[model samples]
Target: MAFAGMLNDEDVRAAVKACQVPGSFDYKLFFTRVGLSARADVQGQRVFNILDRDQSGFIEEEELKLFLQNFSLGA
Candidate 1:
């Protein structure tokens, strides 16, 4: 399946806003809000890219701790 346009900025922002806690992310709520709860592997990769802020091909310790910030700067 095509992966392009799977998630738009508005959807992301809404998901983040709806699912974020004070200092952590609610994965189940966030994925459901983003419609990615049962998505494909490629789609999961897209999420990984978003979380991998440094583009280092991996989610480092700090990145994991600050993953919510990736979806929203003020998160």
Candidate 2:
């Protein structure tokens, strides 16, 4: 991910870390930090990265499945 004067790795890591707490995920803050207008505008890879949480850069099937369910995609 290239910030290109938008953000730094620390910013992303901070946002990711903030969601580590139970039910502490703040979409507004994350989106704001990432320079996304909304979740709908976020690319699939970015979404996966955000949800990855552990910065593993790999979203497991269960993780993606649960995310889809949360969005009512019913995957």
The estimated TM-scores of all candidates read 0.54, 0.37
Point to the candidate with the largest lDDT: 1
Q: How close is candidate 1 to the true structure, as a TM-score?
A: 0.54
Candidate 1 per-residue lDDT, tens place, 1-75, comes to 132477655666797777456655666777777777778988888878877879999988687658545558865
Q: Whose TM-score is greatest here?
A: 1
Candidate 2, residue 27: CA error in Å? 1.7
RMSD of each: 4.5, 10.5
